[model samples]
Target: MTETTIVQYLFKRLHQLGIRSVHGVPGDYNLVALDNLQEAGLEWVGNCNELNAGYAADGYARIKGISALITTFGVGELSALAAVAGSYSERVPVVHIVGVPSTISQKQGALLHHTLGNGDFSVFANMSRSISQVVVHLTDPTIAAREIDRVLRACYVSTHPVYIALPTDMALQKIPSKGLETPINLSMPPNDPSIEADVLDSITEIIYSANNAAILVDACAIRHRVIDEVHDLINKSQLPAFATPMSKGAIDETNIRFGGIYIGDVSRPDVKKAVESADLIISIGALKSDFNSGGFTYHTNTKHTIEFQVDHIKIGYATYPGIGMKSVLQKLLGSLDFHRIRHTESAKSKPPRLVNQEAENSGGQEITHSWFWPHVGNWLQEKDVIITETGTANFGILETRFPKDVTAISQVLWGSIGYSVGACQGAALALKETDRSRRVILFTGDGAFQMTGNEVSTMIRHGLKPIIVVINNDGYTIERMIHGEGAVYNDIQPWKHTKILEMFGAKEGEYMSYAVKTRKEVDELFQKGNEFSKAERIQLVELFMPRLDAPRALKITGKMSEKLNAKMEDTKYA
Candidate 1:
């Protein structure tokens, strides 16, 4: 049998799990493990920094179910902690392998890179104390395979980040391969049968009673891969359906029964009114977070709320209303009053009107975020996937309508920037694996793009071509919104962004880039990128959206900032 190190065993387990890419920058402590990873038939996908790498792995996990990232101890561990915490909150399974001082070195007090003078290896415990499900230290080679399998299985099943500390010397320790076994199937945790029965009975009662009942859903349901079941439930029931912002694009918007994202306050007034006045509400896999439910927890008191949630899915302090979300929905399907018309029949709240209104404003040359997004939306096809950075795109793109069934992947609750590009890389990798023909689209602001832009090379090297559309507004637009008008520090030095694709070894047939200024140019390049005659790599399309105005949310936030700024100025003078 070929001798294998603990590092090799970890990589072998990862390979068995079908994880193709592992993100991180190499440092001396982890060099051995990196080499082991390479030998185990996996690519050590390097990133600009540990934080971005963690976000990339988190994104990959979001799309791929499970992923890993390697980093050295101390600085790298600390840098990646924030993203890992975010993943914990969202239930993304990210396996973090941190290189640490050898077991003996740690006990002997040998001076190590990134070690504090106090000589405590409690750093891992401290950093991940709040989030990770398990923090494993691989000390014994004899149980390495078993322990690794156990911890990896924990991460996958629980959908949380887990840390494995590899001692510097343990990289060379060998272990037998037979001990490792694939984890058992990780299905959703068993629901409380009594509660499940009550939910089903209640849903059956509600569906037969109310003429105007709509099913609402959220991200938790999507995480469990039950959206199709939800769609089927809705179809069988023939009930009108609505979605939360987190569940946007989960169901086809074009379906006559589908009502768009319901942000109770900011939602189309009519949609809100409909939800409020509806005789019954059936929510599937939904969480009643303040941001999602307009601060009024609808399902807080189960006795009063006619809702059901799939149980046992809690992310951090947030305990969602469980399988009530799924089971109740499915149960209601058989009880619908088929004669009732679909909700769209009376939807006074039509899609937002922009072209006519914006044209009247005469800021035709100025590219407001609101104005720019709708145009971009118009360009995308039905099955295209959008990977977005968490900046202006976060606020701007949310305003536009995505095509039915098109996937819009964003770190909405996490709000992590720089996730888009690397996520685009992962998504493109996923596209190739699934043998999908539709292009993976990436929308990122310049600043966020700079944060993880190096992944472009990773994309090219792997032949995973994604159409990267960069909104070159030059700085952190979101920061500017948060910090007010004087925040010039949020800006960055301008780069030849369009040419970087070439610099990254993109061949002529493989990729193309454009610097767009006018709306016409934006339209042209977007059209061309979709059908662009390129044979070598992915198309990198750069559009200089005029920074003439902010998105609606930003504008409101800016007004609030201005008021706060004025109050501060008055206080300073007083």
Candidate 2:
């Protein structure tokens, strides 16, 4: 039997899963293990910080199906906690590998430099357990291969982050390479036939009996890799398909049966009526988080909703446990009687056009959210990877419609402020490896950009070309709309946005930067044949808008959030 080192086995597993690049900042403990990344045919994406690395890994996973993140124990691992937690909340598959102290040192309880002055080495892993689907500490080399495979399987199957503590001393420990011959089982467990058939019958009965039916697609549809099945159902059944905030581009917006985004009360009037008034709504992989559901404002009756989730199926309040969505969806697609089903027409009203009355009437050069987002819909190309930050850009993008095959990455459920910039780097790199021609576009607010702006340097370092649009609204516009309209805490120090690429080490021809305050400037820059539109080189555009202005959806959601916060305070004090 051939023998391999522990790190080699781990990297090979990740490579087998199609993870071409690993994201992380190198630390002392993880240094030796990093050597095997190249040997396993994986490129190391060295990020600016561990937190940014974690965010990048999350984004890469969103694009490439699964990704790996490496960080040293204690301080390094803890810095990535926020990103890892976001992955857990949003169901992104990331293998978070933390290099820990040597087995002998950990056993002897030696106080390490990154430790909390005490000898308890398990503290960091303990902190991560709640956020991870599985936490495995690889102390014994004999079981390290088994544990690694187990965690990787869990991460892929569960579609959530998993933690593995790779001890420094065990990095080079010999492990049997025999297990590598048998690939990890990525298939979903087979659902019980009798229960699945009954559930399918119940769903089909509802569909056949309903006057009007709709399909609501959410994040888990993409995460669990059942998008093909969802699309098949939508096409064959001809039901009006709608995507949630987190699942913006799951369905082609141009499809005749594609209803607009359904965000509860914040949705467009047509979308709201189409979804809420449906006699039967088949919600596939629905994650009804507060923000995703417009502050829990969904008026759709549960009795009329049939939810197909990763683990089970829910038909009119009756839950069928253990029946996964993938197999069930495939089976459902085949069983659906398209001829007998009543297919309702999708809401015909499209999103607002690019023509902005406010800008035209005022003749003001300032780009407003209403104009910018709609204009973005027209400028986007097919198969683009769009990353929106969790602020004004996140909400603003809700108004835009993407071209076919475009992947929109955002932290709607997690709502992390600065996730987009780091995610842009990771996503761009993932696209570079898989599909180089696909453009990666980022929409981030100025305040959010400042949080993870250093990741742009990593992009430049790796020759990843992505268009970075900085929405320079002067401060945190999203925060201002929520509570502190003019509060000092919501403000940020202004920076010269045009010089960012240069400051990040992009030399003259290596990048291009533009400052566009007017609607005309944006139109001209986005026009065909323009250097920015060509995207041959890295491009950064500083988009200027009114500091107090925000997306229509943002205003509604923000006010709702403030009222909820106030009500919570009242309840606590009363």
Please list the residue runs of candidate 1 whose C-alpha ends up more than 4 Å from where it truly belongs after superposition: 1-5, 171-176, 179-183, 287-365, 528-530, 533-536, 557-574
lDDT of 2 at 365: 70
Predicted structure with the largest TM-score when compared to the true one = 2
Cα lDDT, all candidates: 0.70, 0.90
Candidate 2 has its poorest 10 consecutive residues by lDDT at: 346-355
Q: Write one digit per residue (lDDT tens) for candidate 1, span 76-149.
A: 88888877887887778899898888899888877666888677877665778678888888989988887888
Q: Which portions of model 2 miss their true places by more than 4 Å?
A: 346-363
lDDT, candidate 2, 64-140, per-residue tens? 99999999988899999999999999999999999999999988899779998788988899999999999998888
Each model's total of backbone clashes:
16, 0
C-alpha RMSD values across all candidates: 4.6, 1.3
Worst 10 residues of 1 by lDDT: 296-305
Best by lDDT: 2
